[model samples]
Target: MNKQNVTVNDLVQAATKFRDDRDWRQFHNPKDLAISLSLEASELLENFQWKDSAKSMEENEENIYEELADVLIYSLMLSDVLDVDLNEIVLNKLEKNARKYPVEKARGTEKKYTEL
Candidate 1:
């Protein structure tokens, strides 16, 4: 149950095995990975078209999970391609967001970034 070890290791192992077995990593450059990740996310969003939040959240979870896996898998591959530590990048981004969205400015509303 070591969080760091399991979280990233499992993802990396699975992605690595997938790439190796398919021999697809040769084309998974950083630019393509980033584009592909965004494309997968867009496809995920397509599943919930015109659905209410509560209804969509309750139904279609399997589809959502599948799309999310696509997005996340490519994300992991992108991280691998770039030699970036996923944990570190996530932590750093969170820190920056905390500063940018202090509770005083960001609480209790869906304000746009420019508004905040």
Candidate 2:
């Protein structure tokens, strides 16, 4: 589905259905899901380990996509299990980040908000 057309609810529903089909929900508590998410993120990072961005992408594009998908799917599942609204939480975080890192202070810099 197109990015603009798909919603977080859609993703959560899809992930829930997949989990239910496999009877995997039994293993999907908040803690385990969080750990799975971290593991998937590390897998995604592995695509770039010891490689430049362009070369990593060129060599591992498919694996990168799959690992990233795993990360997102686990995140969706975890959010569903927690009964949290993903969009709401993400927007709330963005608002908080904006306050912490205003453009005037954060522009063109890689510094943390505290450093800025």
Candidate 3:
């Protein structure tokens, strides 16, 4: 997606186009969308909050999916505001993290690079 010209003013236009294409606008007003995003985050947290890794791994698939979609939708709104390409940013961030998490010294721990 073209990221440079898509400003906050253009977000509604793009969002409207998306809604019109899929007939989803009835459910995507600013307030409703924000609330839905928060609720979805809570649901996602429900999967792992206060639970061991094994228990978190046992979470229901649909719950995780719904929460992820909610998060992504909000992320798209934020990306639209900043005119950023999320895919590009995410991939770059992953590469940076790989640099920080090399196996030689940073293996099997959650410490930050400074601590390592």
Number of clashing residue pairs in every model? 0, 0, 0
Q: If the candidates were sorted by their lDDT against the true structure, best first, what order would they fall in?
A: 2, 1, 3
Estimate the TM-score of every prediction.
0.85, 0.95, 0.55
Q: Write the per-residue lDDT of candidate 3 for residues 15-80, one digit (tens) a residue.
A: 547756997756555676677668778878888778885777676666777678667666566455
Ranking by TM-score: 2, 1, 3
Name model 2 segments beyond 4 Å from true. Answer: 1-4
Q: After superposition, how far is residue 96 of candidate 3 from its true place, in Å?
A: 2.5
Q: What does candidate 1's lDDT look like per residue over 1-116, in tens digits?
A: 34565678578768878997999988988899899999999989987889986788788888899999899999889888888898999999999988888889899978865789
Give each model's whole-structure lDDT: 0.87, 0.95, 0.70
- The residue pairs in collision within model 3 are none
What's the CA error at residue 4 for candidate 3, in Å? 27
Give me the candidate number with maximum lDDT: 2
Ten consecutive residues with minimal summed lDDT in candidate 1? 1-10
**Candidate 1 to truth, TM:** 0.85
